[model samples]
Target: MSKLRNGFIVLLAVFGFAFGSLSSVSTEAQPVRTAEAATTAQQITKINSTLSAKNKAAKKWIAMRESGRSYTAKNGNCYGRYQLLRSYLHYNYTKVNQEKTANKYVAGRYGSWTKAKSFWLSHHWY
Candidate 1:
């Protein structure tokens, strides 16, 4: 009985409890929704106001292809406006986080959004 109790405790530790039961330990995986619509022009203009001419154009072009500038877009393991890998966003899907994370990712991976756009154009993925 003590061995079984210990094993159950380990299981609980491995999978956190919510409402006294495993919240994320479902038997089936939930499907991720595909992108439905592009972000509104007002939102794009607002975000673009923070960038330079070339960068703004590149960013918008990349976003149009990747996730239509929609912060909620998800394709497979990628998520958010830039379609960054899920691990990169850490499941935080707020617009601010998405923007920050995309800039950071682009900076690290391709040095700038313009370069990323160029790469995306060449390979059809970036």
Candidate 2:
């Protein structure tokens, strides 16, 4: 009788622990809506500002703007906020503006057109 009682108690304890652990465990992943939205918005803004159809001057600006703001990682060789280091300029901008470097240097960073224009106005080198 005692052996049977002991076996039952052990089984109950094991089940209780398992139940407790299962209850404490979360099954669903929580979504970070705000952060995700901000990131997505930024990407969309970047695409619209830089990647979409551009005029010849805009394309030239993206390629050649080699001012200080143009560096990508600050550690790696990323030359522009658009991350154009050497290859992009060499392939695209250099030939476009063989006479001047003005079109090559970045006049703005990753911001709205207004912000970029403001940066250009203030920095004089963006």
User: Runs in model 2 with CA error above 4 Å?
Assistant: 27-126
lDDT: which candidate is best?
Answer: 1
Superposed Cα deviation of residue 115, candidate 1 (Å): 0.5
lDDT (10s digit) by residue, model 1, range 47-86? 5577788987898888889988888888999998889888
Model 1 score (lDDT): 0.78
- Cα lDDT of model 2 overall? 0.46
Best-fitting candidate, measured by TM-score? Answer: 1
For candidate 1, the per-residue lDDT at 70 reads: 83
State the displacement of the C-alpha of residue 37, model 2, in Å, after optimal TM-score superposition: 14
Once fitted onto the true fold, the runs of candidate 1 whose alpha carbons sit more than 4 angstroms away are 1-50
Models 1 onward score TM values of 0.60, 0.23
